[model samples]
Target: MLLKELSALASPLNDQQIGQLQKTVADLSPQQLAWISGYFWGLSQTPAAAGATPQPLAAAVATAAKPAGKLTIIYASQTGNAKGVAKSLEAAAQADGIEVSLYSADDYKPRDLAKETHLVIVASTNGEGEPPDNAISLHEFLQSKKAPKLDKLQYAVLGLGDSSYEFFCQTGKDFDTFLSKLGAKAITPRIDCDVDYEGDAERWRSDVLGKVKETIGGGASEVVVPLHAATSVGTASAYSKQNPYTAELVANQKITGRDSGKDVRHIEIDLGESGLTYQPGDALGVYYTNSPALADEILAKAGLTGDETVEVAGESLTLRQALIEKFEITASNPQQVAAFAELSGSKKLQKLAEDKDKLRQYANNTQVADVLGEKKTKLTAEQLVGLLRKLTPRLYSIASSQEEVGEEVHLTVGLVEFKNGDNTRVGGASGFLAQRAEESGEVKVFIEHNDNFKLPADDDAPVIMVGPGTGIAPFRAFLQERDARGAEGKNWLFFGDRTFTQDFLYQVEWQKYLKDGVLTEIDLAFSRDQAEKVYVQDKLLAKGQAVWQWLQDGAYLYICGDATRMAKDVHEALITVIEQHGGKSREDAENYLNELRKAKRYQKDVY
Candidate 1:
């Protein structure tokens, strides 16, 4: 409030002017302050009228000046993490006084690539090195015969993915390769980051901005885009991966029958005025406190006393506390295995570490506790923390639309529990939410928005959704949202599982939707119902004609489920249908599907 009230400082403002300034800020929220700041900045760019009164420093401070040259940022994200990162980079670039234009990968025209002066891509690898739904069009276009030479362009890329997957950061690699082949110059080398991406992302941003600053000297600005907002209640959200809100767990129930082989949970959390906004395809990220029981086992295996001191995230804590609150100990990876193998010199670990494939298999099959326990590696608290990745939250596809449930979000969480050695291993977040956390207990959560996966903008457009197993989460949100809006679009759903009797997720809701005529047609597939396994793809082939007809009728096709097999098989089935019904070769049929994707008529929420 120092200089905010004009009278508080030595200023030339008259009483009336002071009163006006106070009134202007009286009801303004943080975002309003930010916008007004930009607004005045735009005004400052225009030369002031001659002989006009000198304005307050605040007005001058709000200048929207930018650095020299234009920078284009395009992001391809399935669960919105890359978009969030891209937006963060845009804000940072704006702060450095650079003009930035942000676009979803699909929104940017391929023809424009040859013309871009400066471009940066923040892409996340989807399943098995595949480009995300939004990235597919651009990915294909660059490799297509129509792509132009981009010798005139300068670019950078930042890829985000989980290192546990074999093709970690493969999308970014592909993008870099394609751009190089097209003759584009690298502004800064591409950086591939694992799930613990924020730190690496920050470093990449600083280095890239430094390069931009060197290439394009700061000067007067022109274009302006939405900068990332500081976390506050007034904006869309302040709660995110960095600072999640603590929401209470109101319900945690088993959605599937007790007889089912898989243990999937229906989870609900009370937002409690957190103002967290999410749509149908968004994900709920839950930060869990590692199971104390497991944490103790890890500490004991390292031969460290529970009370031994350790530092994590800049705070000092006991060894036990740090293990539970700071590091990832459940899943093993190549890096972790290599670190342990080298530290302990275990002949068995040494042999496994010699080969990449064998190391990966060992990591996948083992746990952190088991690795340390196997070799009795005596380690200090610091050494142990140094060996592990920072604890990261797990994201579950949101099942409830805000349109249907205000101030509350639902998640379909499939518990990840399996056997390893003599003990049972459970996923960090999944174990916490589904097994450990009691009803009404608090849980930390945030929304990861997905713009690529959305309902048809046209209410009358037909939609075909194929989601089997826990993949049905987002479709539930879709139907709920459609029902709430009284949409008249025909809805067709093809859902499958091992058995209808025990594995059909949300069966009651789909039946209710059918009864209400909201669902135009429904096809069910229960793999174990008969002698032959009948999955969703089987059903799709059975009704291939109708599916192809829907495509011809301007239907939007959506697929969510297992990316490793279900998505691929369903894709093959759809191609076969197009070939048979539309009378085309395999290549033409594939082209047809690609066009559908390019037109945004086909979308997948596969993991």
Candidate 2:
């Protein structure tokens, strides 16, 4: 009778379950009921095997595993590449009956490091060998005085980075080294991967999983959790990075003035009911066709007909089509340059390639066409393809939120154009989006979601955005999103460029936003406007007192710009402001900022 009354909400629980629930709670008070509610909530959020401990937080991070052995998968990604690889590995391991947990480096507490039986770190190195933002705390913790010995820990590392950089996989190398120094066992050697990291990452994952399976005595759970199987929010789209949606280009207008040194386009693409929705800070991946003119030049220089069929990555296509759609023809790196030099047998080129410094300088300044144009070598299509890396899609920070733009996605694309000797060269994607393609033409695209960079969940929290040059892209989306949501959080922006008159992008909308009171304050730094070149950091120092006050008031500080110089300079400036206004020692100021980073008050999206 009581069971029948409890089914008022149309809960499908049978009489037995209802009776069990009633029996368990019949003698309990309201306090006990609340406690029981929370207990079951945790149980639901963390599902484990009958005897195992369910992981905490969300299902994305952990899975229930046997006490004896549980595999841990952790990723420190600047972009979504390493996270994607880690998730794929997590799903695979679960499918193979291996109990596993997946964690973003920031979320995984350092204290639990020693308790882990098996560990795999998939880390991506950011600009100049720096660890990704999420990994900063963990990386520093491991290197600090309070670091613990991991005598029983067995770990493996997979580093994702571009070989073009001097320290290709420095972050991952550091992690592996730190763990090893702390007495952790390395089950497998560290593998540093270049831009095309999929194959190597997969191989490393397989090897690590196999090693864990052999070492661990307890078996995996029969019922597995599928975390990455579907989109966490909204409707899961059929399209993804691997299988992208065919979106048509609707608009590609030059946002920057013609006189400006930069060529930035405000591009719009029609989603057309792809049902792919994205957050403000997410990136849009675009797969573009290479320049036809450049492709023709390569074929002519190689003395090959366009009709010749070539095999690449187990696919057969006409050489001309491959050059246009598949191969990377515009840029050449040291590896590509050295490989070409060896094949062509040019004595001068071989001599230059032998010298690392000269080769790097030569490769950075030249292109594949230049190499082919220099030497007269009769090469087969297959041989030529072997020398070049595959064409990878470019990712641009989205400039418009779906909340404001609806089905159309907007991007602020900065074209990379320069003179390479006698010929003009441009970035593959930028040139295609800005010059070669028409408005009605279709482009393959997908969303690269970033969880690390986001507006505070608390809509009332203030935001301080520092984005200069083309980095202003995502901040545009942020402001648009805040406006659409009617979020009362104060918005402060610091934007810089060469000249405000010619290079101030989205000036009209910002003015309107300011007039509408959506933006609380705006600061501009035109580097060439005065006798003394003033950048964003100078503006920061000038208003250092106010900036420090904002920090004390719990404002979220965000920076998106060039990582090499601007970010470093601004970081030092922030520290100086903290020390000057907050009145702390240099070391204390550093610690304060580190704490802010840990609290997610300071976030960056630098390349």
Q: What is the TM-score of each candidate against the true structure?
A: 0.84, 0.84
Stretches of candidate 1 exceeding 4 Å from the true structure: 1-68, 219-235, 354-358
lDDT of 2 by residue, 1-607 (tens): 4545976756756665666566655664433343344445566676464557633322311122222477898899877888888888777676555567899998999889988889999999976788887899889988987788999999999999877667788999999999999999999999998877766776787678778868753233323323334223233888887778999899989988879988989999999989888998888989989988999999999999889998766889999999999878887888988887888888878998878878877887788899887789999987888878889888888999889999999999889899868898888899999977774388999998887688998888999999998889999999999999999999999999999888999999999999999999999999988999999999999999999998888999998888778998999999999999999999999889878877878888887
List clashing residue pairs in candidate 2. Answer: none
Q: Residue 434, candidate 2: how far off, in angstroms? A: 1.1
| TM-score, cand. 2 | 0.84
The whole-model C-alpha lDDT of candidate 1 against the native structure comes to: 0.83
Question: Cα deviation of 55 in candidate 1 (Å)?
Answer: 26
Candidate 1 local lDDT, 571-593, one digit each (tens) = 99999999999999999999899
Clashes of 1: 4
